[model samples]
Target: MAELIDVLLFAFLLATAFYVLLSRDLLAVVMVAGIYSLLSAGMFLVMDAADVAFTEAAVGAGVSTLLLLIALTATGRWEKPAGHRVVPLLVVLATGATLVYGTLDLPPIGKPDNPPQVHVAPHYLERSGEEIGIPNVVTSVLASYRGFDTLGEVVVVFTAGLGVFLLIGGPRRRRGGEK
Candidate 1:
């Protein structure tokens, strides 16, 4: 049943992606992108990645969609045509192919003997409470072991929000038009 839901969600995501790519209407594209993000959040939920799903729902579906809609309101609703697509198309195909090829080298999902499980996971699970003094292993890993990475992610999200704010024309003018 879970696998069936995953497949359906994946299919919906693919269809939404294609629609977003083919549609020239910016509003329609933004709406479909939100749908894609929602499907992604659902997929993460089904995979038991609640934290990731929450981020996807909040950042991807919520913030990103709102920003895009705001930007669309400021800009034209139609996308301008490009002069050349061949180079961009080639680049996209190459990147997609490389990603698919790279995934082939990944260990199968839930494989107990995988490198992370064999090496890093055990150390974290056993010593995290002792070293970091955090009862929850996930919190320990994110807060202590992977602190820099988590900080980097937070910084990126903050930067993106700042960019959106700048794009949306900042704060409203005062009654006296003071700077």
Candidate 2:
């Protein structure tokens, strides 16, 4: 049943991705992007990463969708037609092939013999209580072990949001294009 749900969610995500690529309406694309983020959040939840799922729902679906909608309101709702370019298509195909090939080498999920499980997991499980003094290993891992990484992620998100808001809401120049 869980596998079935995963397949269904993956299929929906694929369909929405194709729709977003093919649709010319910017508004529809934004809506589908929001849906994609929601499906991603669900996938994260199913994978047992509740914190990641919450962040995806809040930042990906909520803030991103609102920003895209605001952008559309400031600009136009319809995408202008563009001439087909072969280089980008080739690059995308090459990158996708590389990613698929790379994934082929990954260890199966939840395997105890996996590198992280064998190495990092034992260390964290054994020493987290003494080292971090946190009862919850997960909390210790996130807050103490990987605190810098988490802080960096937060800083990046805040900067990106501020940059986008500034770009959209910044003062407009006169018709003469003066500063």
Candidate 3:
């Protein structure tokens, strides 16, 4: 059953990725990309990284797509063709190779016998509430260790709102009218 779910999820992610790549319509591509994020989040959850999956589901699949859609609306839909440029393709290939190489060093997913995660996490899980005074480990970790990142995210949101307001609420020019 789990295998079937994994296969379906993988199919969804790959299909959406293909749609994003092949679609000429920018809006459709953006929507497909959002679906890809959502599918990826689902995959992460299946792998038991629930916190990371939650973040991916919210920020990647929800907020970022909305922001991208709004920006696309503010700008234009048509993207320029890169038919003449081999550079971008080469860059993507190189980055993908680098990522694949990096992944070779990662601990195998869901290996209960893995030494690294087992060593530190059990202690953190057992004592985090006592140490941090928060019942939710995720909230405690984020509010403590990742406080700066959370603040930065808030600042970014504020800046984006400021930009949108400026774009939509610019001063009106009095042109040949008595007001």
Candidate 4:
């Protein structure tokens, strides 16, 4: 059942990607992209990465979609027509192929003896209380054990949000009030 759900989710994600690529309506594409992110969050949840799923849902589906719609209000719903470009297509195909090939070397998921499971997770589970003084392993890892990495991730998210806001001509206001 879980395998079937995973397969369905992947199929939906692929469908959404194709929908975004083929559709000329930019608003529809953005909406579909948001759905894709929400679906991705669901996938992460299935993979037992609840924290990641939550972030994806909040940022990818919620904040991004809202910002895009706001941007669209300034720009328009339809995308400009473009002729087929072979180089970008070829580049994307090559990059995707390389990524797929690289993933071939990864350990099978959920294997007890997987490198992270064997080395890192155990240490966190064992020492999280003593070292981080946090009862919850996930909280301890994110807030204390991996604090620097988590802080960097937060910074990146913040920067990206700011960039998006700037791109959308954030808060256009007259001397008196907002336009």
How many residue pairs clash in all the candidates, one count each? 0, 0, 0, 0
lDDT of each: 0.90, 0.91, 0.85, 0.91
Residue 128 Cα positional deviation in candidate 2, in Å, after optimal superposition: 3.2
- Per-residue lDDT for 78-146 in model 3, tens only? 776658668988999999999999999888877887885688667667888788888778777677756
When sorted by lDDT, best at the front, the candidate numbers are 2, 4, 1, 3
**Local error of candidate 1 at residue 59 (angstroms):** 0.4
Q: Model 3 reaches what TM-score against the true structure?
A: 0.75
Candidate 1 C-alpha lDDT tens digits along 53-167: 8889998999989989988999989999889999999999999999999999999998999988898899999888789886778778898899999999999989988997896
Residue pairs in clash, model 1: none
What's the true lDDT of residue 29 in model 1? 97
Number of the candidate with higher lDDT, 1 or 2: 2
Runs with alpha carbons beyond 4 Å of true place in candidate 3 = 113-119, 145-179
- Residue 17 miss distance in model 1 (angstroms): 0.8
What's each prediction's TM-score?
Answer: 0.81, 0.84, 0.75, 0.84
Candidate 2: give the clashing pairs: none
